[model samples]
Structure formats: structure tokens, C-alpha cells
Target: MSTDNITKEKFVLTITADSIKSTDPRFDINNLGLGDNYKALDAKFQNASGTIITRDYKKGEHRNTNQTMAKLAFQLFETQIINLPVEVKEKFPVYKENVDSELRYGIYSSVEDFNRYRKTREYMQYHYGDGKVFVIYSWNVFSTILFVQECLKRFGEQGDKFILTYREKDIKESEAETLESNVQKELDKPISEYRNPYSRKLIESKNIIFRGAPGTGKTYLARQIAADIVSDGYYDTYESLSEEQKQQIEFVQFHPSYDYSDFVEGLRPRINDGVMLFDLQDGIFKKFIAKARANYENSLKNPEVIEKETLVQEEIISFLNEVEFGVDQFKTIKGSIFYISSVDDKYIYITIPENNIVNKLSISIDEIKQMLESGQEFKQIKDITRFFGKLFATQEYFYNFPIFKAIRGSRKKNIKPTISTEKLKKYIFIIDEINRGEISKIFGELFFAIDPSYRGRLGEVTTQYSSMNSKVEKFYIPENVYIIGTMNDIDRSVDSFDFAMRRRFRFIEIKADSTTAMLDELSEDNKDSNVLDNDALKDEAMKRMDNLNKAIIGVDGLNENYQIGASYFLKLKTLTFNQLWEDYLRPLLQEYIQGLYNEDEIMTTFANAYGYNETAEGEADEAFESEG
Candidate 1:
């Protein structure tokens, strides 16, 4: 049989017999069989004739023409095997090269001989594809028989065990999982177990006004609520929104001069061609609107479903263009823009033109456009009424003034524009000093904005004040936003908050106390001797300090008083026994008496409080010397 031009598909070659039986070394078949073997002569003739065949050679024919057989086998192997797939080829270039070179040599006779084929490719491909192939001399040879037996043993075994043992490597473990678990545990713990009543009420109501004497933790509670809001994943829903539409939260402080310009927007200074020019600058409300617009735009990009502000400038312009020309035409109009005038008589006006004959006299489209373009125009209207109204709403003449047309117009419309409550629910606004600010001045038309009953879902409501020049319209607040405020109860300049403002916030009180777990935790001394005997001792010390504060106020004539809070106690613990008398005890005694009492009075107070005192002002030095 000829090995050349072998095109048999799924072909296998196995040695079945051997004709050489001589043990004599002199009987050379290489010389004899080269001419006598009929099958060998036929294979050579068949190759010359270009006929395809699968050939099996006996041992005598193999040894006689091993050199010619090897050459022909190499050429046949090269043309027979397909090149490896690209991914496999890439990972084992050297193995591929060695396999191609070894096939050219035809030296493989056993599994080990094929493995000598080199390169991880040969090993991977051999196992991954067809089972191992063996080249044996003849069926009767012991070495060839053993090689075939071993190849058969490995052919049917699982390939994965071989791959794991020889091809793949193991990975090292990481500490990140442990660290993440610890962090998650800490985050899962609550900040405080106690439920804050004021926070609960504020959450339930649309608007709540905090009113209380100083030292109450109204602002603290507000901050706590803000923290809870941020941590509880409430704002995560807003994350899907565009940067503009999510602008649901805002905070601004109100003062005597905090007019409409500061709350909405105004024209301010800018340089154009080296000349100072007035540029339109957005106020807190307008700034917030811009942010909401951005958020809305972004939210639209997300795949998730979320609330978005659909109103655009084009819609607003279209609405303005659709209004009919007539005195009563402006009565039914609605949009986002509204004008708020904060005079002694505060009122909100919608941007639409009034229908009354007296109100529609000389209003122009140009004026309306100007109001839309520059927020400062709205500020000017507010200033005109504020100057005429004397900044206080309680003045009878100002309330009755007929010239306050804009203020009267807002009152006539009954509409009060406010941030929608739907917008408020998405973000948080923190006010640093809630009590110090003028609530009425800051809230402007939004007094109604914070009220739940007048929220955005309720639509527009009109109210009439006076009819001097024109009537005005204003819209209601939306439901999505929230307000958080902080206050230092210690400030004295402002009188107690107004009742109307008080009704809009929930108040929570924070007081100095000994029973706090945080205080006990901090008081534990890790150094040599513990200054506190136990949690009970710390509580007693706090009580005594409070008593000392009361005694000081009782003895001192000044209304300005001081309390020995937790901070003072921390400082007291830092002093040595002798230093405590001189630095803390004596000074406290002197402060208690308002500097009226002399050194003896101070020493007596110290002895009364601590049951011990330094012998004299400087006697601690002598006592130290005596002890030494």
C-alpha cells in the first residue's frame, strides 16, 4: 500500500503482521527486501502513478526502506493535518512550529515521542481534538505493542483533569471581601435609636414652623432629618433624572433687604467691551429651576422610568402666543412664570395680563417680553412697592394705600406661585440659621408654597387685595421639594419666631444631660487610674456641675449667664489635682460671683463644691516640697 496521496477520510493505519522471523544478525533485509518485497515495490509504483491509498507496512519492509518511508511519511503528514484555529495558534506558536517540524521528521513511535513534539499547542490540541496517534514497527514487536496499549489507556479519560493539572494556574485570595463586609456591617447600624417627634411631624405635614425658646435642638433635628433623607436612598430615585429637573431643593436666608431679586433673579454687573453692563443673574429660585432643567434633561437619557419636567421654553413661548387680544383674555392663561411682590402687603401675581378696563390701560407686549428676558424688571416692581409700603405689613396706611397697584393686583388674583411639592420630594435644602433669618422676608410668595393645601397638585387659586392700577395672578407650589433649617437657640437679638412662621416647622429640643450614652463612652479613661469610678460617678459630676451653674447665676446680678456644659467637664478632667484648684475651680468661683467676691470667697466656693482646697493661693508649692 502506498502512503503518498492518501485521501481516505477518517482513515487509521495499524501494523497487523511482520515477515522477518530471523534472530541471525547477518540476515540483512534492508538489502534484500529493497528489491523483493512485492507490497513495497507496488507502493512505490502506486505513488509514481499518483494513486491515493492507506498503507500498512510490515516490520521487514519498514527496516529495509526506513529512510525512504520516513521521507514520504513526513511529506504526507504536512499535507494531511489542518492548521490550528487562530485562538489556539496564538497561544502556542512554538508548539505549532515544533509539531510542524516533527511531522517533517516522522520520528514519533510512542505517546512520549509525540509529546517530545514540543510546545503547549501539541499537548492542548492532542487532548482537545483527536486521541493520540501511535507509530509502531509491527504487531509482534514488544515496544510497539506497549506504546499502543498506553495510548489506548489515556484516550477515554476526562480531559478536564489533564487541563487542570497541566494547562491552568490558580489565583490568590484577596482581602477586599473581608474589608467590604466590615464596612457594610458598620453602615447597617442606626445613628440613634430614639424616634424624633418633631422629625416625624415634619415628614407628615407639608409645612411646619419651628418655634421655641433658645437651646432647643430644632436646627439639629432638621440636620438629622436631612442626614436620614440622604442616607436612606430617598435621593437615589432622583439620580435617574437630568441634572435640571432634579433641582427640587433650595435654601436662602432672608433679611430686611432680601427682596425679590435675591429670591428669584436680577440683572447684575458684568463687563462688555470694557464697559460695566447689567447682566441677568438667576436668584436662588431661578438657579434651582435651571438645575431642575438640567436634571430633567439628564433623566430623559436614563433607561429607567422617572419623573421629569416636560415644560420647555418652546411650550412657554407657544402659550404666550396663543392668548387672545382682549381685556378679559389674560384671565384664563397659565404657565410656569409668576411675579412675587414683597411689600408690607405681600401678594403673588401671575404673568398674564389683567382683564379689568382700569388694569389693561397701557400694558405692552414689549413690556411682557422684557419681564420674561430680564428678572431684574421683576425686582424693580418689588422695590417700588417696598419703598412705598415701609417694609412692614402691619402699617394701616400702607395696607390701605391705593397706589400699591402690583401688591393689590397679586391679592386680586388669589394665585401664589411656589416650588412644586413633586419637585421638593427629590432633593434637600439646608438652611444654616433658621431662627436668625426673617422668615416673612425670605418666604415671600412662598408662604403658600410651603403649605400642603396650596401645593402644585391643587392648581392655581386667586385672591384680591386692592384695586388701584391692575389685578395680578400667581400659581401654587409643587409637592416634590423639602426644606431643612438649622438654628442656634442661643442667639438673643431676634424676638421669638412669629406665630404664622411657627406653624410651618416642627421643633425639637436638645439639652445638656448626664444620661447620654455618648458621654459615658467618652468618659472612660484608658490611662493609669480612671478619673471616673463608673458611669454613676460621671452622672454625679455632671449634676454637680449643673448645680454650680445655678449657684453662679443666683449669686451674680447679671442676666447674662453661663452653663457648665459637656465641653467644660472635658476640660476639668484634663487638669491635675492642684492645677484643677488654680485653673478651673478658682476661676469658676470668680466667674460665679461676677468678680464681686475676693480670693477668700472663691476658695470657699471651691471647698464647698469639691470638699477640698489648696491651703493658700501659692501654698501648693510648699505642700509639694513637704511631700518630697
Candidate 2:
């Protein structure tokens, strides 16, 4: 009756036959009077189903003759007289005098009996617990210690004894197996993969812009980040990306000329019936979104497709193996001859000759075999001979099958198929020099959709030319398609960025440290390859560039934005100290110091830092004037 014995543990309550009827004197079964011949009390309880249920036996007995307690007996029986609310109001509560406890005591016939009681409740409640209380349900004696509100209110009067009667139920083997199997599956999967740094921010914001000074590796880092997300940690660089992964990525430059007509959907002039007519066409961004969306939706419908490609390929091969062939391998009708060349873990190779057109029929190998067996002539699908080219094993088209059209992430021949697996693919659109283009003009109505809170179809809006394309009246940027844009702070100040576009993107700054690290890598590579005439030259080059950047930053109007990057000095291998300054660094410095009163003096100081000679300085001045 003391609630202090309860401990916080997993809800797995195990009760054995011996625990109910033990030989020990501390817990005597004979005293309880639960034996083979004992009969239950006639007392009954009504359930929601209106079924009148009776107790097998209670701690105190009920006799038909005297209506008094009978001698205790013991025998395990399976049936409950009263329904106990499995719907527990509290969960995992520490039993204390002052605190309300989620832990409740009830007698259950079996684990399944407890589960049934749980199904009728709203909150998640389990019947499993570290046993501190005992329960038994049977026709001979239904004995269990229960915590009831009525008994607790009158604890001193009741003397801490609350007996309940319930029946036992059987547990099925199949039900036990299914529960174990589901638990095993849940345990096998990894909990974290895309949970990398910046992933949460990018996922929430949906759009991010990487802005920094030139040569800060903004473009390189963007591509790496995009590759990482798309490949799901399988790839992090351009060279590491698979052909399919490459398809999920797109790179473009934004300039003054870039517009909505080129970036999104727009009306284009087309020659229809020998007359010029305007036709609505989707631009790169829209097309990319479609591809990403198709993959995303397909992934949901077929999640196993992500890692189960080999199984699909095997199915295709097994189906093809059943095809009946006469000679020279498995040849299709219509003279489009093809045979299974080989089969590997990842691909099913089908060899077909150049002249052997394998189109006209658009179906799986199983379907074709069935049709041929039924003597059904297949109608030729015109201009589909090229489609069969993808099936040729020589071209790595093993996964292509008629059952489900493959979502090829190839940029070429932007074919819009009815089904796609783009959702499975993390599509990235990298916009270089993003601020160079007019944001309001290029994005147009898509500005609303770019906001992270407004992402997905919920944020869809009608485009400017929505009236022209009935099929695409409303458009939204998909969640899977990540956007990355890079900008040079020197070219366009942060203040110049539109406020409308500002809140939508998470901006990250890349500084001169990135450039220095890049140079260090280049230097190490040159040293290992023995390409440098003098190793010390690399160090001097780094110092000069760093000093040059500081000097530019110190200039009256010029800040870190206008500071020269390491890329300029990275050309040190072929050019000497004087040539590097006179040809590249000096000419560039001249441009930076242009229109200033101290221009000549500043040029002299920069030239001196580069150890410029009188002749080299004269040549730099002449080259600067000619450029102007």
C-alpha cells in the first residue's frame, strides 16, 4: 500500500506462475486459497459493451448459501470479470507522499490484456514495468494489489487492502513476432546523417547566400556544401560526385543581363506555322525545381528506392532472363535485337548493335514476353528507337525498366517525364555573382516563395506570365531544391542589397583567411611536385599578398572589400618578382588608387613594397594609362 516502493523504469511488467503461487512462507499460495477446485465469487461488473462480467474470485470470498468469505484456493484461469482502465493518466511518475503519480496499480490477465486496455485510452500508456507489485487472474482466484481512489481516500478505515478480480488472456505468436520485428527495424536505422552544422539553418531558411570578398572560395565552398547535401555525405566535391549526383547540382552566373526570362518561366518567341508567336516556357530554375520535386515525391512513395536500386536492377534482370530467345542473344521483334550481355551487382548489361533499333514497344521484358506468348502484335511507338538506347548495357542503363520510368538527372535533353525521383535527390542551384543581377526582376513573384516560412506549395504564387501557361499558373520553389548564391562585397556593398531579398537568405561571410589557406594548399602541392624554383618564394609571395591586402585596406576610401586576394599572387610560378608587379599587381594597384590626390604617392608606396625598380615602375605607369 506504500507508494514509496515505486521506481522509475521501463514499462515491462513480467509476472510468472511461480510469482503468484510460490512455496516460500513469506508469500504462501496455500493461504490465498487458490487451488484447482476453487470457484469464483458471483459478484459482477458491467462493461461499455453492456456485457455483465463476474469476478473469478476476490481476496474476500462470496458464497451463495451464507454470503460470507470462503476458504482461499488457487488455480490459474484466463478471463477478466471487470475492465480496468488501461488508460493511465500519468506516466513514469516517482511515487512520493506529496506528488501525484503517473504509476497506477492494476491487475491484468496478460501483456495483451494490458495492451487492449491501453488501446481504449488517448495518451501513450504501457503495461510493462519493473515489477514491485504482483498480479494473477484465474477462475480459482483473481488476486491483485490495486491502487484505487476510493480506497486511498479512506486509507485508515480500509486498512490498506484493495482486491480486484480480472480474467487472463492468451498472447498470439504472430503478434509477439510483429512487435519484435518492428522494434528491430527501428533500432537498425541511423538517427543522424544530415544533422551537420548549418544543415538545420539551411533546412529551416531553405535559401542561403554566401557573400564575401573575391577569391574567398565562396563558389568552391558552395559547390562542396551542395554536393554534401545531395549525396547525403557520400560526396563533398565535384570530382567525388557520381553522374546521378552531378545531375542534382546546377551552376549558373548572375549578371546584369540575367532576368526572369532566363532564370524562371517566361514567354519566348517561337516560330509556329512559319509565323512568330510567343510561347510560355519554363526557365532553368523552374525546370530544376520540377526535377527536384519529382525526385522528392518519388522518394516518399518508394523510400527503399534510395538504397534499393540493386534490388530493382536484379528484378529487371530476372524478368529479362525469362524472355525466350531463338539465337544471337535475346532479340526483340521489329529487328531491334538485344541480348543480356552480363549482370553485375549494380547493373544489368544489355548489348544492342547500332543499327538494331530497339524501340516501337514501351514495356518491361516480362510484358513483352507475355505479349509474344499470347501472339499479340505490339503497335510501333514512333521515334522511340532512341529511348531504347538507354537500355543498352554498353551505356550503363541497367536500372532503366518499363515498370517504372527512371528519373535521369541528366541536364541534357530536359525531358519532363510523368514520374520522377527528384525528391530523393537534393538539387542545388548555385548562382555566382548573385548581386550582379537585379533580384526583383529575376525572381519576380518568386520572392514570396523564397522565404523559408513560405517555402513549398503553400507559398505558391501566380507568375507574371501565369495567364499564358494554364499548366503552370501557380508555382512554388520546392523544399529539396537548395539555393546558394555568392557575391563580392567589393563589387556591391551589403547595404545595396534589397531588403526584400535580405530576410529570405542566411548570409555567410568568407574572408581573406580562406584565400591564404588556398595559397598554402597551392604552395604545398608545388613543393611536393618539385615545381617551384625556390620554396622560400612561396612564403615571400604569401607575405607580399597579405601585406598588399593590408595596404589596400589602409587606403583612404578602400577597405577589406577592395583588398587584393591571393589569386593574383598565385601566378608566381611563371612570373618573376618584377614581372608579377609590373604586369599584374602594379596595374591593378594603379586602378585602385585612380582619381585620388595621393594616387601617385600611394602607387609609389605599393610599388616600393613589391621591390619595384625604376624601369618596372615606368612600365607599370604606361600599362595603367593604356588600360584607362
Candidate 3:
């Protein structure tokens, strides 16, 4: 039999139909084959001859008949079987391959097809015995071509298809590049190229010694530099800072007794938990350093935005750092930028943002001193302003000024000037006879503290004081403070200054005749016409003072002590005709030139030098005689 007709044979069998009813509503066997059947034979079936057949009948069909019946049974069950269409079945084996190929060629209609292809590949991995077979089954030549096309589409022209794409990597690289550019921009300009002399490059020098004869403005220049640095922002022009910024500056004085406890911070008696204890207080140096660090941190976090609280904290911390204190150990506080005085061992630590940059400068004191001595004029207003602004705004040190108040005749009250609580930027401490003080004895270990290299760092020399029972204390100077000292070279009292102390300051000489032009200008001003208008007279007075300085210098054993100052010439403006003779001219002749003069000749010499006789009494008479 052919396969197509294999289910066509049938068998004749009889069964009773109890009732002609169907379980399904749509179709029933009675409706098709039992049409018009009567109720008399409802539960029974009869053969074509109408004869009853018993269950024990021995008659049966031939062998071919049994086979034909079996075939008919199979045909009856065929309606229950499932079958696919010939066209679908023919393509089923290669369907996934074709779909995957389309996807790989960038022709995917949807992600579902792509996912199915991926799943098929994964399935073949476990089912296929050989890896090569799995690979071949999973990827056809067409599918491989499609995959390459899909990869090219997903990744842009410059993108690498093999590597996984990550947005974070690109973002991080961009950030790194930005940071590098910013850092490079800041480093591009050399510090020395800055026009301001008071900037870090100039102030941080190690060997700077200010030298000049008395009143030549050496110390004044130093003070100006300090003010400029401390009062103004490091990068801002001098005019930019608000009044409050200028007011934040502080000053302190260093002496032989001044120690680390005073400058860097130390423990002092305090009540804690109702018990007396030594509470550690941060010193000026430590406070300043802390401020600098805090400022730096804030700048990093908030950039240019400054809050009031931050400023206050910065000021307080800077003050604490400037003085020596034991509390610094617990807090690990460091020193800030500062300056020191050779006299009285005074030092100040100015707490300002500029100090952070200033601390990094590597300059020597000698170089600064040389710059001042060379007198290379600075022209830029910004430079001058910055130099002066820092000097006044930052910390400074000074010796005690003795205020002599007359209590009674022949007796006086000598009181040491108090430490000034006024803002450092606005104040100037002038030492009239700075060189007269014993430098080493007064400054002690501060000699090195004043030096630039050790000015703002830790682990340098410490100072011990008698008041603290010789306990060592850290000392640091503030950058804002300025020191001005006037020296009389002709005075014998200045010979005790240590060489080291002399080297730390910048000096400028004030020749007695140097100010003749200024004096003439002062004399010519009509605002006070009656006040000695003779430029020639002022010139002569300056010449005499120079002569006096020369004479003193010529004396043996008086090299350091023999330089006369311009201040002595100023006395001429203050003395009356008679007072000049009694207070100055007569005394000088008697003490230094008495043996060389005759009795009558000495009076004549005094008359010529003083420009008046002692006998001239009234002001009107003296004026009339001069005019005549």
C-alpha cells in the first residue's frame, strides 16, 4: 500500500448506541449516521438482514480483513495528531541561521530576533558534543557577516568594538585633563617675576640686612612690605582688601626672655571641670599656620567664596600659632609666616592667606639686603603698595619703649610700653636708638628665628626665658609686622650689637646733608613763614653735623660708635638763641676743645657757631639786629 492511502481500510463491527446523543454541541454521530432511527430499537443495533448477533459467535473475517480493520482504526485516530505545513517543516532546520545572519548584517527588525539567535548559540554549546560543531551550528557565514555589521553600527567610527564601552572612563579622563591644565597654568609664572618686592620672593629671603645711617628709611621699608602682604590678598592689588582685612593684622615683640611658649603656644593655668589645671593655649605661630591651612582647605572646597565664620576662625587660629604653646602638640599645629626683631628678641606671626604662598618662597636675607642697598628704584604702584601693605598688615616684633614720666625734680618714672593690642597694619613701632641695645643679650635664640629659612617652620632653635624658669619655648615672627629702628653711629652705646643681628636687617643711611633739599622745601613753605626760612642756614647746619660725625669717626676705638646721625641737626630748630649756647655750643667747647682754646677765644668761638651772643635778650631785638 502507498503511504498516502495507508489509513483508508475499515472493519465492520456492531455496537449498541444507548441513545443518539452527542457530548459536543456542534456535531453528533447520530445526526450523521443514525438518521430517522425509531424508538423501538433505541439501545440496539441490527445487521443489514435484521438478525441478532450474539457475543459467542465463532465466525470471523479473513487475515487481510484483520489488517484492514487495524488500518481503519489508525485512520480513525489520525484527526487527533499534530502536523506542520510542508513549507514550514522544510525551512525549520535553517530558520535560526538565516535570522542570525540578517541580524549580524545590521538588518535586525527587532531585539527579539537578536536575543533568539544568542539563545540558540548558547543552546548549541551544551548540546553539541564537539566545540567546533557548536560554533559552526551557532554561526553561519552569513550570520558572521551580519554580526560584524551590527558591531560597526553599535560602535561609532572611532569606537573599538572588542572592548566594552564605559562613559565613566571618558568622564574621568576629561576631569584629569582639566586638573592638569589648571595646575600647569598656576605654575607657568615664576614667583620671582612678580613685580611686588614685598611678595614671597622678596620677604622670604634669608640674608636680608637693612642698613643705613639713622633715619634713612630702611626699617620703614621693611614695615611697609609687611603691611602690604598681610593687609591685602596675595593675588589682589593693595586697593582690593576691605577695611576688615587690613584690621586683622597683629604684632608682637621678641626679647631675650621671649621663648617658644610665647610664640608657638603653651600651657597656662586654667579651670577645667572645676579644677585648676594647665590649659594649653595655641601660640601666635601655631594659630597662623592653622589659619593658613584652613584657608587653603576652604579655598579648595568653596573656591573664591569666603564666609565670615571662616575668616574669624582663620584670625583666631593664626594668632594662636604665632606664639609658642604646648597645646600645639595635641593639635599638631605648625607655624605661620612671621618676622622677628634682633632687639628685645621680639617676634610677630601674622595670620593671613598670603602667608601660605609666602612660606613656599626660597629667598635669602642677604639678597633682600643687597636689593635695598643697590637702591634700584621700584616704579610700579602695585609693587610699592603690596610691599607696604603686607608689612603693616602682618605681624611684627619690637623692643620695649621706655616712657620716662617726671615724678618730681631730679627723679623720673620709667615704665615699659605695653604690648599694643591695636591692629598691626595701622601701627608702627619706632625704635629711636635700636643699635644701643645689646643684640645677643636681648634677642637670645630669636637670632635664628628672624632669619628667613627658619621663620615659618618647626624644629628650629627654641628660646628659654628667666620668667618661665628657663623653660624653652618656640618663637615665630608674623609676616605683617614691620620693625623700624634708628641708630646713632656716633653714639658709643651701639658697639655691643652682634654681627648676626646686624645681618638680619636691611639698612639705609641718612646723611646729615641728604635732607638739605627737604629741609629747604620745609623752610620755603609760606604756610609757616616765620619758622626759619633759610635754606642756606639748614645746609650749614647739616654740614656741621656731618663734620661732627666725621670727627667722632676719626677717633680710635670708635668705628661702630662714631657715626653721627642727622637727628642732632634737628635740635637747631628747637633751640632759642640763649638756649643754644647754654645747652649745646658752650658745653661742646668746654668738654672736647677746652685745652685748645683761650678763655676769651672760647666765648668768641661759641658766638660764631651759635649765631647769637648770650647777652642778646629779647626776640624783637634779636630779629631787628639780624635784619640790620
Candidate 4:
């Protein structure tokens, strides 16, 4: 994407998703006068001109991945950090590939070195056209993690959000592929076979609102997008996430009733000793923000500092692992022998516990460490209950607490925060049905904080209930936290997202066809004969959908947003095709034409176009697909 075509007012940052860019002159190695390069060999020799850079080779895949963690970072910067525009996207920075940078930053040592790299003589002679070889170190393209970092840095939620695609290879193998080519392959992959690159890139740069028709799988896609970013493109499906990884995401459904108090922070009534009392509580967004901020801060901490405080915990863990299981070496407060089973970062498993109701019981490592570090004497379950509050006040604590005490009694070790390694983790906040709520009422002063350019301390908001805070502290969303919202184009709420708040987010139209990948789940490739052949059924569904959508668009107000999405056909999982049409699709279409001047005629047109026929009540289930 060139600057001439960009709408400078479109967003606070602009990201260009060029095809994996080898064909572009930006990646051509001999394409000299290129902006810059990285050179480690003659470090200071070329700096006399004051532009050349010397960087060590040690910044390998980790550096690239972080830069490619396009999801973790945002668009590259246009100017100095402080000069970033808050209300509109920054001016596109003028960038070009230069010989100095190509030598310093590109994969090859220099343009000459790249030309000389040919261990695969036959392959190069057959496949490597002189201009086809892509190797440049220009302003990163394909909306790179480097570019996202530069562009989206305006919005600051600091966590390691990696969106990586490059693979490691031995340079000596005479590699035939370039990083741009590898990325191109990924981008070109079909939706059913790959994550949506557009969604990933959009959410990376700023908070996104997905506007589309109902059944577009907008809500589902929104969460999946979050999972993809949180995984740093490692995994896209939300179900694939482990319990620990799932904690990085939070989902909320917005309704007309949702307000600032419910979203930001509010007071809830709590009965304390029989008297009703109001207590200030963190809203879901605020609570999630706290977690994101903790990770962001920990990621910034010096590893050596954390390690210094973690030695004792490390020694205790080593001793526990070294101990043999099934020996009945540890005992509970009742003196019932229990054997150690396993230990992980967070929990300890014990085998053959006195409580025979189950084979083994797991205990928290941090809780034990917390108890140990407190220097508090525990005579009974009450002490554990007092320390951890009501959650651990159960009978399970009675057994587990003593084992922790027994283990610690022998080792005399205390585990601190250092026992848990710090990593930059992405936190995703997803709001389904975002348009249902009145944006201004729900967000209030957050409109200022939500701007991509105003992230961090500069965008801190003294929330509505500031007096409830201990010190009237200001709250800010961290750089690592990303927001995704879904909206139906035809929602009837009187109050909608305010224009100002709309400007704070990047809005993308999620057309019905763009989300047909959802239909892949309905496939029954080798099921019983009674079930319809999935491929044929899918094709039929797609054909009918196209006819109906094409007809709908011909109407005055109806457009792609009014068309049906693949998600509606998901009913084929249990409901038959006719059942889906009559019960679901028909009613939705009727509703669409309810107030039209030719309501009945339009409804008939839609039904005919959709191929609806009550006579063939059991219309053979047709396969369906959506792609853009």
C-alpha cells in the first residue's frame, strides 16, 4: 500500500498487508539506495557517514519472531514516540531499502554475498532467476511484527504477543525459499485450512469492531481472533488453549443494560456480619487489565533480580523432584502416610493419600510457598483457611495443608514470586454484541484511554468510583491488552456506539462470505449412508446462499450485512435442510422485508431465490462454504 492511496484519517496507525513482497523492489538485494542494513563485521568503519549500523548476529530468530510477533506489536512508528497523533493515524513514514541496511540487516552479508550464496547449483540454475531472489532489509512489509510494533505502539498493552511464520533453516543447505515467499504461502492459504490473516493484522494494530450480518460467526471469529493473537499465531482455535493460556482471554456480552458501572468498576452490596454494606469492586475489564499489567511489569523486570530471590524455592523444588514416589515419606497432620506423585510449576500431586475417596490429590505449590513465606504457624485447617480465605477452607485443605507443612518442615524452603517465570503474555478482551450497549455510557471517560496513540500512563482514567480507591489511583489499560468487539449491522438499539468512540477503534466489515469457513465443522466425509454427503450438501448450500444473497442485495436497504452467513447452516448438525430453512432462515428473511413497500412480494422473491419449497419438505442437505 502506498502513501498516496492511504486515508491519513482512517486510523491512528496504518498497516499495509502487501503480498509476501519478493516481487517488490523493496526486497530486491541489488536494489541499492535501499534505506538501511545491519552489519556486524566492520562495526565502526562505515559509521563515519553517521548512518550505517553494526549489529551482532546473536539477534536471530528471537529478534525476528518478536518483530514478526506483529500481533504482539503494532504498526511501526511514523515519528518520535511523543509526537504520535491521538485522534488520527500518523502520517505514513517514508521508507526505502538501502545498500547500507541490506548489508547490515538482510539475510545475506551483502548484495554480493547474496549473489554468491549458491550451494544448490542445479536448483539455483533451474529456479533462481536473477531478479526473483528476494533479500532486502527495508522497512518491514506485509504488515510485519516490526511494522505493527512501530504503528500500533501507540496503544500500549505490554505482553509478548508473537505472530510468527518464519522457519529456521541451515544457510548451507542452499535454501530455495525466502522469508517473504514463506509468508506469502501462509497468507494465500484457504480460510478452512488457515487463520484469517486480515483479522489477525487488524486486531494487532488497534481495537477492532467487526460489523456484519447475523450468523456471520462474528462472535465466534472475534474470540478465535483473540486466541490466535494470544497464541502469537502458534494456535488459532480457542479450544486448543490450555487452562493457563485461557486465562489470558476474557469475553463479555454487551446488552442495552450494560453500563459504565458494570464495565469499568462499580459497588456491589455485601452482607458483612448480617448488615448490608456496599463494597467497591473491580469491573471485569479492570480485573483483566490488572492481570495484563502484572505480566507486562514482570516481563520488564531483570531476570537476575528474580533469580536472586528464587534460590530457596528452586532448592525445595529440586529436593521434591529428587525424592522417590510410593515411599510414604510424607505425612499429613493426622500422621497418615502419603507418597509424592509429581510436581509442576504450580501444583504438587500426592499418591495414596489417607483420604481414600480418590487415588491422588493435587496441592498448590504457590499456596504452600505463600504459607511458608508468611512464617505463620498452622495448627489446623483453620490457619490455611485464614490465609487463603474461603476457597481453600474445605476438608481438602485439611489434608493438603499438612503435606505442604510436612514437605516444608524437612526442606525449610520458601518460594517467592520468582518461582513462576515471567513471560510477556497477550491478554485479549472480547465484547460480543458491542453495538447493543450505548458506547458513551458504557465507556465514559475510557474514550480517551482507548485511543491507540494514548495508551499507557498518558491515557489513564480516574474512573467514576475514584473515591472508592485507597488513593484515588488512576487506571490505565496496559499495552499488551487487545480489544475485539462484534456488531450486527442492523441492531435496533436507539443508542449506538458514539462517533468519538467509533473513531477510537478500527472497524472492519465481516461479510457473510468471509466467514463460510465455519461450515467446515459440518462436514461428514465418511459418515453413515443415512447422512448426506457433506461435499455435495456444502456445495448446494453455497449455491442457494449465493442466490438469496444476490437477491437481497438488489433490495434498497439490504446488502452483504443483511445476507445469511454459514453459521446458519451449522444447524445441519442436527436439523435437516428443510428444517433449517422453514424454522430459521425463512423467519429471518421475512423479518428483513417486514416493512418494505412490497413486503409479500419481496418475501416471495427471497423464498424463491433461496430455493425454499414445502412440497419437497425433506430437501436433501446441501454442503455449504463461505470465502472471500
Best by TM-score: 4
lDDT of candidate 1 over 467-586, digit per residue (tens) = 221333343443334556554444552456556766565554444442133335335751323343445445655655556555544544532223334444443355433565466656
What TM-score, to 2 decimals, does candidate 2 have? 0.49
lDDT of 4 by residue, 536-576 (tens): 56676777778989999999988787899888987777776
Order the numbered candidates by lDDT, best leading: 4, 2, 1, 3
Taking all chains together, each candidate's TM-score versus the true structure is: 0.34, 0.49, 0.35, 0.55
What do the candidate models score in CA lDDT, each in turn? Answer: 0.37, 0.50, 0.36, 0.59
Tens digit of per-residue lDDT, candidate 3, span 433-518: 55655566555566776654343333245445323421233455433323445565544555666678777665555454443433
Better of 1 and 4 by lDDT: 4
Q: Select the stronger candidate by TM-score from 1 and 4.
A: 4
TM-score of 3: 0.35
Lowest lDDT sum, 10 consecutive residues, model 4, at 38-47
The alpha-carbon RMSD values of the candidates against the true structure, listed in the order shown, are: 31.2, 19.8, 41.3, 17.0
Candidate 3 or 1, higher TM-score: 3
Off by over 4 Å in 2: 1-204, 271-277, 302-423, 492-495, 524-538, 573-577, 610-628
Give the runs in model 1 whose Cα sits over 4 Å from its true position. 1-197, 208-218, 233-260, 285-426, 457-476, 486-490, 514-628
Task: Estimate the overall C-alpha local distance difference test score of candidate 4.
Answer: 0.59
Task: Summarize candidate 2's per-residue lDDT along 197-314 as a digit string, tens digits.
Answer: 5444455456788776676677777776777677676665777888878888889898888999998877889663375766567798888887877665454443334334433334
